[model samples]
Target: MTRQPFPRLKASAAALLLFGMGALAPGAQAKEAAPLRPQVAAPLSSFDAEVNTFLAAYWRMFPDAAVAAGRYAEAARLPAPTEALRKQQLAFAEQWLQRLAGLNKNTGLSAAQAGDLLLLDNHLQALRWSLTELRSDRWDPTEYNVADPFAQLLNKPDFAPLPQRLKLMDQRLRQVPAYYQAALAKLSEPSPLHLKLAIEQNSGALSLFRDDIPRAIKQAGLKPAEAAAITAHNAKALSALEEFIAGLQKIEKAQAGAGRSFRLGKALFEQKFAYEIQASVDAQTLYQRALAEKEALLQRMSAYADQLWPQCLAGEAVPADRSDKIARVIAKLSERHVAPERFVEDIKAQIPALEKWVVEHDLLTLDPSRPLVVRETPTYMRGVAGASISAPGLMDPKGVTYYNVDPLDKYTPEQAESFLREYNHWVLQVLNIHEAIPGHYVQLLYSNKSPSKVKALFGNGAMVEGWAVYAERMMMESGWGAVDGKPSAEMGLMYAKWNLRVVSNAILDYSVHVLGMSEAEAMNLLQREAFQSHTEATEKWHRAQVSSTQLSSYFAGFSEILALREALKAKQGSDFKLKAFHEEFLSHGSAPVRMVQKLMLGQ
Candidate 1:
C-alpha cells in the first residue's frame, strides 16, 4: 500500500460543509465554486458547514493529495515540502483542532456524523503530531519524491483527452526542477536507509522522461515548438533528479554511519500507531497479542505438517524436532512453485478465478463494470512491498484499479527461488485474495461508494489493511480451499503459514522500532519462528526500517474486525448475514474499526 503522509480531504464534502447551510464563508466561494445547498437540518447543518469549510481549506493546502484523491483539475500543482510549508500545515492543523472543539459543543449528531467529527479530530491531531513530533519531512529524502505523482498522470491517460492531459503534464513537469531543488535545500541529516531508497526510486523514475513522455508527445501530435518545450522541460526535470541524487550521495558519504536512525523508538512508535493504525489497543498490547497468536499459529501449522508428512514423504522418517519436521514439509511444498518469469502472469490469471469464487459463494457483490488491471510494479515503487493495489480517485471511480505485482526478472537465481517459494502456489492464491480481488481493490471500490466522504478520503490504515487480511480468513472459512466440500490440508497448512506473516509483521515492526531488534534477531524471528524464506525476511527488514507502525496494521485490524463481527453476530443471533455484515461494515467507508464498530452497533 502507498503511504501518503497528508490526508486526502474531500472536495465536494468540504464545499457542502462550507456553504450547505448558508452563503460561502469569506474567500471560500471564489476558490471552491461549488453550488450552495442550504440545509434546514438545524445542528446537522451547523456541523456540516464546519466540515465543509475545513475541507475547502484542506483541499487548497494539499492540492497534491486532492489530485491523488481524484481532483484531476488540481494535477498541475506540486507543493514543495519546505519548512515554511510544514509550519503552515502545523498551524492549519492547530486551527482546525480549535474549530472541531467548537463543533463538539453542539448536540444531537447522528452516529455517522459523530463518527465524521472524530475522523476530523484524529486527522487534524495526526497531522499536528507528524509535523511537530515525528518530523520525517526533515530527515527522510524519500518524502521529497516527484516520481509518483508524475507516474499517476502518465499511467492514467484516460483522465483527459491526449492534448488536455499533455498540457497538465507539461505544466507539472516544468515545476519538477523547483520541487527537487527546494527539497535538497530543506533536507537535514537524512536517514541512510531512506536516502538509499530515494536514490533507487528517483533513478528508476527517469524512464518517464526518457521513454513515456516521448511516446506521449508523438502520440499527441503536438506542434514542434510545443514538443521542444516539453523536451526541454524533461531535460531540466532529469537534471534536477540527477542533481538531487548526487546531493544525497554526498550526504551519505559524509554522514556514513552517522545518519539519523530509522527506528522510531518507543514513544514515537506508540504515538504513530495511535494516529496511523487508530487501533483500540496500544502498540505494546498489540505486540503481546501477536506473540500469543504466533504460538497458536505454530501449533496449528505443526498439526498440518504432521498430517501432510505421512502422505507426501511416505517412506521417510519424520524428524524428532517439531520445528525441523515442519520446516522440511514446507520446503518440499515450496519446490512446487512456478518459474520466475510466470510470477506476474500467474497473478493476473488468478484474479478472475478469485472473483468467480467470491460470487459463487454469495460472499459479497462484485462490480463487473469497474476494471482491475494487473501490471508489473513500477520501478519507482518496487522497494517497499512485493504486491499492492493502486485504486482510482473518488472523482474517477470508474477508472481502472491497478494491481501492481513486483516481477522477479531482476532477481538473481537464488533470490528468485527464495522469493517464489515464499509466495508459493497456494499462498499466491491467498495473496491474490489479499492484494487484488476481494482485497484492496474490492474494499477500496466499496470505499469510493461510501456516503461518508470523510471516512472515504481520510482512510485509516489499520481498517484498510485489516479488511484485506480479514478477507483472506473470510474466504478460507467459507470453504475456498475445499475440494468437493472436503477441506484440503495442504491449503490449510499454507494459509496457517501465510497468517504467520500477518502475526510476524506486527511483532517484527514493534520489536524493531520500540525494542531495537537487530537485523540478526529479526531474521532469526522471521526465518526460525515464522517459517519465512530468506528473501522475504530481508525485504521485510528493509520495509520495517523505511516504514513504522504500518506492518502492525494487518494483525491489529484483523483482530478488531473479527471481534466486531462476532459482537454483531451475537447481538442479532440468527438474523446475522455474512453479506449484510460485510456490506454494512464497508458502507461506513474506511473509518477506524473501533469507530466503525460503534457506528455498526448503534452506540
Candidate 2:
C-alpha cells in the first residue's frame, strides 16, 4: 500500500483525485500561452491552457492533498465533504472531460501530449464514476478522516514557521466539526468492516488533538491567550471526533447484520479493476491466469521440497500430499527468523545490504542522495497492510520516503511467532526487496523523475507493484541469496512460497468479491494451498474483506512486467542490456504496463 498524505475516499479513484493531482509542477499556468508555431502550436497551446486550468481547480477540490504536495496556499482550508462539494467535483470532472475531448480533436498534439490527454480523460471519467457509481462516501465512513491532513500540517515543520503552521492548523481545526458532521450526514448503512476501521483509526487520530497539538503549542511558545483559544478549538474538534465515532457505533448497532456488504460484487469489482488497475486484461482473465500460475508454483515448490527433504526433514518419509510436503520443509526453515523484538530492526538493517547488492549486480543505479527512512507505521495508518512505502510527493522529490513497518510489540506471543514464520529469514528478505530496495522505493524515485507529470502523479498500481514483484525475481536471477552461483534448495523453496502469496492474493480477491468465497474457504486456500501461517492468513482475510482489486496488484503487475521485459528483449535481441531495460521501462513513470509497452515497443 502506498501511503498518501490524505485519505483515499474511494479506493484508487480518490488517490487519483487527491494524490495524482497534487504532484504536477505547481506553476503549470505559466505554460498556458507559450509561444507556438502558427498552425501546429495553437491547438497544443489551447490544450496546455485547459490542463493548467483543470489542475488549479482540481487542487481547490482537494486542498489537503494540495498542502501535502507543497501548495501551501491551501494550508488554511478544509473542504467540507458535503453534497455541495460532491456536486462541484462532479461538475468539474464533466467540464474537463468535454474540454479535453475538444482538445483531442486537434491534429498537432505531440505523442507525449497525446498520452497525457489519455491519462487526463481516464482520470476525469474515473472521478465521475466514483461520485456516481462507487459512491464510497455513502458507505465508507473512513473516507472523512480530518486528522490525516491536520497531522500532515503539524508534521511538516520545514514548510513554514511554527506560528504560521500553527495558524493554519487552527484554521483547519475550526472546520473539523463541520467535516465530520457532513460525513455523518452523507453516510447511510455504512459497511461494518469500514465502520470498525474508521473507529479504530479515528481513535488514534484523536491523539493528534489530545497529545501532539498540546505538545506543539508548548513547544511553539505561543501567547497564553492564543494557546487558550487554540485549546478551545481543539476541545471542539475532539468533541466532534468523539461524536462522529459514537454515531458510527449507533449505526453499527442499528444495522447489526443488515449493513452494506464489503464485497464490490462481480460487476462493480470488474469495473473497479478496470479503473483502478488500468491493466490490459480484465479481472476474471487475470484471475484465471493466477489460478494457472498457482498450479505451476506448486509444482516448482514440490520439486524444491523433494530436493531439500533429506537435508531439512532427515529420514522422514515425504507426505504423498504436495502441500504437506512443502509445508513441512517451510516450517523447518521458518524457525530461522529474527526474534520478535528485532523485527523492525532487522528490516532496517537489510535495506543497505539490498542496496549494495543491486548496485554490485548493475540491476539499477542507486541514488545515494535520496534517502529511504525505515520507521514504524503511524497509529492512524496501521490497520491495513503490514508494510508500505510512503513516497515523497513529486513536488517534493527530495523529501523523505518512509518505509513503514507495523511494529510487533502489540501482538501476542503466538501471533507474533506465526507472523514471524510467515515472514521468515528468507521471506523477510524478499519482502524488503518488494517494499524497498529496487521495488517501490526505487521505482517511485524514478517515477518522480519522469518527464510527464501525468504519468508520475497518476501512477498505475499494477505498474508500481508489478515492478517490485519483478524486482524480487530479477535480484534472485542476478545471484542474490545464491550459493555457488545457484540458489540453495531452501532459498528456492522459500521464494516459491513467497511468490505463491502473490498468486494467491489475486485468487483470494477475485473469489471473495466476485465468487463469494466464504471465510472458511478463503482460510483453507491461504493456509492449506498457499502455506501461509495462521496469523498471516487471518490478517489477509480481513484485508480482502476491506479491499478489492488491490490484492491482485502484485500478480497482475509481476506478470505484465515480466512479459513486457521478454517482449522488449525479444525485439531488441542481443542489443538489450539488463540495466538499460530497467531504466528505460521505469523512465515512463508508473503508466499502465500496456501503455508502457506501446511506448517502449514503439507500436
Candidate 3:
C-alpha cells in the first residue's frame, strides 16, 4: 500500500484507451474533439436525429423533473406529456430502435455510443413491458398517482407553475376513475400480490397528497378566483381518486381468498426477468447467485467483525430474536459521528469538498455539465426515494441531480429510535455514496453523455446498482470514508450490511413470488435474516412483490460490477487508472458490466 502511494483518487487512462480507443487511437481525432469550448462548439447535427428524439422524450416523461433539474424553462414551454402522448413517444422509440436494426454494436461507437445502444435496447424492453403490463396487468391509477406522474411533479421544486402542475394533477386525477375502470375491465387475471401490495402502497401514500395540495396552491399565491377554480377542479378529481381507491379496495376483497395466488408464468417471467435486468441468467440462476452472495457476505461480515471487533459474534445461520440486537449494534457503532439534525447540511458541505478532492487527486475526468444537489426528499414522496437518486434525463446533457432523503419525520415519537437508527451517520454517508456523488446520479450523468441508446434503454439493474455499491466499497478500500473523515472500516462494514440487505431483497423476492412464502413469513425473514426494522421490512417486502424484477437489481448489479472491476484491473494491469476506469466505466451509463467490460476493454 505504501510503495504504490495509491494516488488516492486518480483515474485510469487505460480505460479511455480501451473504451474510447477509436478516439484515442492514432489519428482517430473525432470523439476526443476536445469538449465544448467558449469559442467552439461540437456540431450538434452530427448526432443522430433518433438520438436527439431519445433525449427529448426522456425529458418529456418527467417534464416537471426537466424544469426542476433546470434542463428547460417552465413558462410557455412543452406541456407535461399526457398518457396518449406518452404512447406516441413510445411508438417513436420503437421506430427509432428499428431504424438502427442492422447497425453493428461496435461499428464506430466511442464507448459512449455503445452505452447509448444498450440504453436503446433496455429502454425499449422496459417501455414495451410497461405497455404490456398496463394492457394485461393492473393499470390502476392509484400507483401512478402515488409514484411518479403526479407525485414527482409535486416533489420537484419549480417543476411547473402551480396552475399548470395542478392541471397536470387534475388530469391524472380526472383519469383515475376511467383508468381504474379500465384496469378492472381489462385485467385478464388478478395479480393477487400485485393488487394487494399496489393498493396498500397507494393508499398509504395518498395521505401525503391529501396534505400537500393545499400547501402547493397556497405557496403559488394565485388569486381567489384562481384558487377557487383549482379547488373545484381538484375536489372533483380527488373525489374520483377516492372512488377509484374505494373500488380498488373493493377489488382487494373481491379476490380475498387468493392471497399471493399470482405467478408470472415461466415465459412471461423469463421475458420480464431478461428485459428488466438485461441478464440472460434465469430467475433460478439469479436466486442461486443471491443465495451464494448472501452467505458470502455473511462470511465476510463475520471476518470483518473478527478483525475489527473481535468480541462481537455474528451467527452463520438465522439468529433468533436479533432485530433488537442488530438495531442496538448499528446505533452503538454509528452514533460516533452522525449528527441527525444536520445530516443534510453536512452532506451539502461535503459535495464541493469531495468534488475538489476528486479533481485535485486526479480522479476520473467528469462532465462539468452535470451539477448535483443534496435535497431533503419533499415531505411528499420521501418514502420512495428513501435515499435514492432521481437519475438525469437523457435529453439534458447537464442535468440537476437530486440526492433525495426520506427522513423519518412521520414516525411516532416512540418509534423514532427504530425509524432513524437504521440511518446512522456511517450508513447514511455510504447511502449518499450510493445515491449521489460517485454513485447512481454520477453513473447516470455520464451515461446521459453516452452516444448509444441501447446502453441507456437497457440499463441492467445489476450494472447500475453494482457500480454504486462498488463506488462505496472502492472509496472505503482507498481509505476514504465519512464525508467528515472517520474510520473507513465502519463504513465498509455498513456497506457490507447493505450488500447483505441487497442480497436479502433478491432472496425475499424469490421467496414471495416463486417459493410461495406468505407476507407474514416474508416479514419475519426480512427482520430476522436481513436485519430490517419491522416497518422498514414490511415496506420493502411490499415493494418487492409488485416491483418484481426491480428487487433483484441492487445485489445482482453490484455483484456484476465487482466482477467487472476485478476483470478490468486484471486486464489493464499496471495501466489501470482507478479514476479513468471509473470515469470511462460510468461514461457508458448503466449496462450489464459484462457489456461494459467488452466496450471498455476493447473486446
Best by lDDT: 2
lDDT of each: 0.78, 0.80, 0.54
Per-residue lDDT of model 3, residues 457-502, tens digit only: 3345567666777877776666666546566456666777877777
List, residue by residue over 214-260, the lDDT tens digit for candidate 2. Answer: 88888898899998989889889999999998998888888886789
Which residue pairs show backbone clashes in model 1? 17-49, 17-52, 18-52
List candidate 1 segments past 4 Å from native. 1-46
Cα error, candidate 1, residue 23 (Å): 31
State the TM-score for model 3: 0.71
Query: Over the stretch 302-385, how does candidate 1's per-residue lDDT look in tens digits?
Result: 999999998778889999888888898999888889888888888888888999999998989999999898898888877888
Mark the regions of model 3 whose C-alpha exceeds 4 Å error after superposition: 1-47, 52-122, 125-136, 139-143, 146-232, 257-267, 307-361, 365-372, 376-385, 397-399, 451-458, 482-492, 518-536
Clashing pairs in 2: none
Q: Provide the clashing-pair count of each candidate structure.
A: 3, 0, 32
Cα miss at 27, model 2 (Å)?
A: 34
Q: Write down the TM-score of every candidate.
A: 0.92, 0.94, 0.71
